[model samples]
Target: MNNINTRNLDLNLLVVFVTLWETQNVTRASERLALSQSAVSHALRRLRDRLSDELFVNGRGGLLPTPRAIELIGPVREALAQLDGALKGAAPFAPQYEQRKFRIAAGDIIEFLILPRLVAQIAHEAPNVIVEVLPYPQRNDISSLLENGEIDLIIGAPGPTSASLRQTPIISVPLLTLIWQKEGLTQERLPLNLYLERPHVMIEMHQRGENVIDDALRAQGLARRSGVLVQNFMAMPVIAEQTGYICNLPAQIAHVFAQTFNLSCHTPPLDFPAPELHAYWHNRFDTDQGLAWLLQKIRQSASGP
Candidate 1:
C-alpha cells in the first residue's frame, strides 16, 4: 500500500469514486450526486492521479473497475460508512456493549413510576450503562441546566419549554386521593363537602408555593385545606399514614402506595386533569443514538413490556 498524504486528499473525490463504481457509468454517477458529467469525469481523473492507477476503464459493460480499484472498494466503503455515522451522531453508541453514564432530573413520582422498570431494562440490555437520578430542580431553570450539560434528561410535567429543547411525553398520570384505609372515610363515596373540610397533604413539584390541585380548586372558587406541603410524592403517603390528612397524588403512585402501605385510593371529588409526564432533552441530543436508545427503553417500560 502507498502512503498517500491525507492532508492533500479531497474526500469528495472518494464519494465520486464510490458512486461511479456503484453505477459503472459517469452519467449515472453524476445524476446520483447531482453533479455535472464533466465534474464526475474530473473527479475520476483526479482519483487516478492521486493513486497512480487507472481506477476505471471503459469496456463492453460500459465501465469496469481495475484490479487496483477493486482492491480499494472495500476500504473506501468502510471509511464512508464511518464518516456518515459520525456526521449523523450515530457513532460510539452501541448500547448493548458501550459503557455510558446518563444523568436525569425527575420528580419522585416519575422516578417511582419509571425507574424500577428502566433499571431492570438497562441491566438486561445495556449492563454497562449507569443512570443517575438527580432531584428535579424546584425552579424554572431546567433550560439553563440542560444547556449547561448539568443533566441529560428531565422527566416531569410540561411547563415553559425552551426553543432548543425537545419534549417527548412518556406517560400520563391521573390525580387520585390517597388516605389511610383504617380511617373508614372511604366506606361510602367521600362527599365534596367532606373532602374540602379535611386537612390534606399536597405535593409541591417546583416549590413555587402553588400546587396544581390547589390551582384547579381556586379556579372553581374552592380550595383544599392543606395541612402539610411536601416537595415529593413519596413523602405524602408516609405523612398520611400517621395523620388523618388525605394526600392528593398521581394515580400510579397512589395505587402503589395503597397496595404497599395499606392505604385507600379514591377518585378526587373535583374534576382534576391528568398531568403528562415527558422526557425532555436538549435539541442537540435529538439525533444522539444513545439517547434515542435510552428513550425507546423508557417508552417501552411506560407501555408495559
Candidate 2:
C-alpha cells in the first residue's frame, strides 16, 4: 500500500512512463515522447525511486515491465486517463477535426432505433469521429464496461441500478407485444391468461439465471413458456415472424419492424411495465467534453426534434 497520492505528482512524468511502458524501449520512447533518451531514462529512474521498485528490465531485446510494474499498471493507467479526460474537457469540442474513436455498448434494439439517426448526425457534424457499437454481454456487466473505458456509453434500460453510474432519460415508450398481422391476433384487449398461454420469444441479455422478463412475469404470478431465447432484440422480430411466436419489445422497434415486415403490434394484455431507455455512463466521465457532446447528440436524436 504505497500512499502514492496523485495530488502532488508530476503529470508529465506519468506520460513519459506510459510511453516507455508502451514502447518498451527507452530509445523508442524518447523518440515518441520528443525527449532525449537520457531524459527518458532519467524519468524512469525517478519513477523507480518514487515507487521503490525497478519498474522495468531489459528482456528479449526490449524493456519489459517487472512484476511490480504489472501491479501498478491498472491504477496508473486509470489515473492518467482521468487526467487526460479532464484536460480535454477544458477545451472546446471540435469533432470534425478531432481523430478519436468512441465505442458504445448497446443492445440490438437500441442500435436499430438510435444508431442510424446518430450516424446521420455525426456525418453532418463530426465526419472524422469513428463510432463502434459493441455487443452488450449482459446487463450486470454494463457498469463495469463503462467504468473501464471499454465502452464510452451504454444505451438501454437501466439495469438494476448503481450509484457509480449516471443515467439520463432519453425516452419512455410503452412496451408492446408484436405478432404477425396474418396471425389474426386482434388488437382488442385480451386477458393475461391468453397472453401467457401464447408461445413467446424471450430476450435474455444477462447470465444464465437472471432473466428480467421472467422476473417481471413471476412478480405477477404468471409465466410464459419461451419458444425461443435469443441474445439480441433485432433477431426477435424475424424469429417471431417465422415461428408465429409473440415477443415483447419497445414500441419504436416494433413499429419499424412491423412496417418493414408487415407485422402488427398490440398492447400487452398483462400489466407489463413500460421500458425506459436511458443513456448511461460511469461517473468518471460525467464531465468529459467528448462524452458530453456525444450524449447530447444521442439525446437530441432520440427526441427527434
C-alpha lDDT score of every prediction, in listed order:
0.83, 0.79
Candidate topping lDDT: 1
RMSD of 2: 14.2
| Candidate 2 segments exceeding 4 Å error | 1-89, 138-144, 160-163, 207-216
Count clashing residue pairs in model 1.
0
- Candidate 1 deviation (Cα RMSD): 5.3
Summing lDDT over every window of 10 consecutive residues in candidate 2, give the lowest-scoring window: 205-214
TM-score of each: 0.73, 0.64
| Model 2 / residue 53 / CA error / Å | 38
TM-score of 1: 0.73
Which residue segments of model 1 deviate by more than 4 Å?
1-85, 88-93, 138-140, 186-188, 207-210, 259-262
Provide the global lDDT of candidate 2 against the true structure.
0.79
User: lDDT of candidate 1?
Assistant: 0.83
Across residues 222-241, which tens digit of lDDT does each residue of candidate 2 receive?
78878888887778888888
